[model samples]
Target: MSLAAPSETAPTTDSKVVVITGTSSGMGLAAAVAAAQAGWRTVATLRDPSRADALREAAVDAGVELDIRRLDVTDEAAATALVDAVIADYGHLDAVINNAGAGHLGTLENETVADVREVMEVNFFGVLHLSKAALPHLRASSGRLITVSSVGGVIGQPFNEAYCAAKFAVEGYMESLAPVAAALGVTVSVVEPGAVATEFVNNINLDRDAEVAAAGAYAPTLRAYLERTAAQFLNGAQTPAEAARTVLEALTADTPAFRLQTSDWARDFTAIKLTDVDGSAVLGLTGTWIG
Candidate 1:
């Protein structure tokens, strides 16, 4: 990924090149469209490009074109190859949105460690692989690196041990990298969103009845957690488009913050954990989620 020199470029309200993953749906799709609309040379990527119909339709409707490609973020080789290709074709990569992840709903007692590893491979390592592969190019362009994390990253939730652990890993990794990356002329930011209206839940592919049947002593607590979580998503979820706005801001801002929350609710939810010294506040708040 050696380059001639750093240059001001592509999507951040410029013709700068930006690569976004998981754009087949959700915030990824919306952010890809918004970046294109904002005058970026946007590369929208997904695990399977064949499922890009909705992304294509959205582009056509928005009257903005995008370079859609296949990118399984979990594959380090695939990530590096696409990045090299983007650099060769576009000349520079000014920003990246790491948003490719599947949903997982399980507790350690009910699921094997293999399940947790699979979740980490996508949610945590996926971001790591793509971001690592793109670092040289981003440094060459003094670019922005943003990831769409969840509030779960900040607050551990019941029945979501694997997902929360992975996201927490992402947040910690990025937080530690921010200062080091900043010195290298790259901006790193993590955007945390609360529950959003998207296919994220359905994408988990969980069979509630089967999971409950296998829960043994933990079935009742799991049921309560599931019910509460469903009601929250049903009654108080933000739109993917709404969440995408924060990601866009992180892309183009002259001086973006190291951390951002998609909504006020997300801000408040994470605040409890941030300000909690003894973990009592976070525990008290998350405790009611299952009760």
Candidate 2:
């Protein structure tokens, strides 16, 4: 992985230093672009340094430079070192975005423990390590911590047990950090998103076909549900650029919201507090308790 220095023309700003992880693609890339476009000094870190061409191009197109680095979120020591380096150079850190995560699809029974652990390590532990490293800088600068969670973190979805668990854990962690962060003049927000047309789903690690085979029986049911949901969200699914803008707004708002639901489904989920419903009420629909 090769680290690319920010271009000479890269946009510069004071008191707006940001470090974003998993910036090689998707939301992270989009967020970095927005920050750079807005003239914020951005440290964009991707797992593979060689793959930062797109980010650099985006920054160049925006007439700004995005300082690029190679960062593997799962590596604790590396995360710490990178945080130190950013603080050393920038003199202060304004925000940290933990967007390096992947998904797994299959039944809990069918998925191996190792698979579940791996999911947690990246989605949950990665945030933990990165946040821990950045807390001090955040305290000094009165910065914000924004994490990319999922609607799955808000509502349980089929064949997403491990993924949901990791998201839920993130929510809990953020909630616990709220007060501590607040006392130090820092804020935290979790961006919960519904399905966006990203390559994220395509990258799911489903090594066992038997689980997929079992899930195949419900393919029609799932397909119908997904189609209906997608149709409703596809139009509203904010592009990566749009989502990044929202994140930036959240970070700099005079009074930032603790949770940001990017789409209608996420908004509805948050509005209703789905966890308040009982199993019987959930089981009984339209005066029919089929289950």
Candidate 3:
């Protein structure tokens, strides 16, 4: 990937600095460019800087520049070092966007313990590592801690046991931390998006046929769920740009909401749990997908 430098006008002392992870593609890449265009000194990090072509092209097209860096959020040392380096370069770390995550699609019977662990490592523990590394700097700057969660975080879906588990952990972690972070002058928020039209589906770490063959009694339900999910994606899925805009809103809002959804569909889907503690609303709705 080409590493394009920022415009000739380098970031000034007063320019706000924001770090976003997993900007190789999808919403993270869009958010990085949007943030830069919005006058932020954007530090866009990816697991492999070599995969930053799309992000660099988008930044160039937007007539903005990103301080692209290599960061694998799973590495605690790397996460801490990146935060330290950003603070040293920008004088203050203003915000951290934990957009780095992976998707898993399989039941416990089809997925090994290691598979579950890998999903949690990227989707859940990655957030924890980056947040812990940046918390002190964020407190010092009254910064924002925004994460791109999924509708799955709020409502568990069929065949997404591991992914939903990880996202649920993230929502719980952020919701619980919001008040404490507020007391320390740092804002914490989670952005949940539903069926985004991105490479996420293509990038899911699962072999559908293999999973179905191994599912035994669960094969029919798993197949039905997958077919329905594909239909939903085809019918109407929010664009990555739309989701990125929500991330920007969460980052720039004066009084940011603790939990935000990118689209009305997501909000309505998540609202079921809030309105019905018994979870019958969401459970019944999801059951239709498997049937």
Candidate 4:
């Protein structure tokens, strides 16, 4: 199905214009639909519009419309142009959801520096590019800036060093910017989700066999960690829709929080840091995964 052309006419309403990145599938797709249902003029963007069939189908199935556009967060020019086009077309921009991210797995030694840089480019610098581009428009509207971080941001896990590093950077970047943005009336928030069953997990760019083979003495532990992670997905995982609701809540809350976890499990998991300042609690838990 072909997506509607990017709208040039400004939508009429007390239109809360929200731009969500990575809407080809998963939480981004769900968030775009949910935001539209909640009466926002939702601009759902993805790197490839050809891959947006699922998003379009879902929106049609739910009887909501999305202003779908092509946006590759990794391309600085495209990122800037997309935001400029959104404001130019819609006349106002209220919220920007930095949901465009890629997942990585494997130890630092197993993955190449190129691999680490690729993940960071999408997961960390992508947020920076889009957020920086949208800040002026957001400031003009006293808008919301929400980025979808992971529970791994606060607590590291085995074989997720690069992914966790990027998320941790996202959390830090937003946390540091939140107070300053608040001074200008833009509320910044980070949503941390645990084990959501989405393409985000299925599409992780990892070669487990290759990683395990390269591990040398760490092979057994790497295999065990992979098995345990698979079990976690089977036993406890949120739906993309459930995760999207958290994003929606963050966008529309009367007084939005600086950080939000999508599930009670996520909250409890992240609480390890707050409950224990030494960081031993999370470290000890992660250690068990390797053993």
Clashing residue pairs for model 3: none
Q: What stretches of model 1 exceed 4 Å from their correct place?
A: 1-14
Off by over 4 Å in 2: 5-15, 205-211, 214-236, 279-291
Judge candidate 4 against the unseen true structure and give its global Cα lDDT, from 0 to 1.
0.89
Least well predicted 10-residue stretch by lDDT in candidate 2: 282-291
lDDT against the true structure, each candidate: 0.88, 0.76, 0.88, 0.89
lDDT accuracy of residue 190 in candidate 3: 95
lDDT per residue, candidate 4, 15-70, as tens digits? 89999999989899899989999989898899887888898888888888788888
lDDT of 1 by residue, 28-123 (tens): 999998998998888888997567888888888888878888888989999999898887777789999999988999888778999899999999
Predicted candidate 3 versus true structure: per-residue lDDT over 1-291, tens digit per residue: 214554323445588999999998999998998898898888899998678778777888889978888899899999999888887777899999999998888888766999899999999999999999999999999999999999999899988899999999999999999999999999999999999888888888557787677789998998898888888999989889998999999989888888999999989988887788888888899899888
Runs of candidate 3 exceeding 4 Å displacement: 1-12, 205-207
RMSD of each: 4.8, 3.7, 1.9, 2.2
Pairs with steric clashes in candidate 2: 10-65
Q: Is 1 or 4 the stronger prediction by TM-score?
A: 4
> Per-residue lDDT of 107-176 in model 2, one digit per residue for the tens?
5555589989999999999999899999998998888899989877866666577999999999999988
Best by lDDT: 4
In model 4, how large is the Cα lDDT of residue 10?
Answer: 40
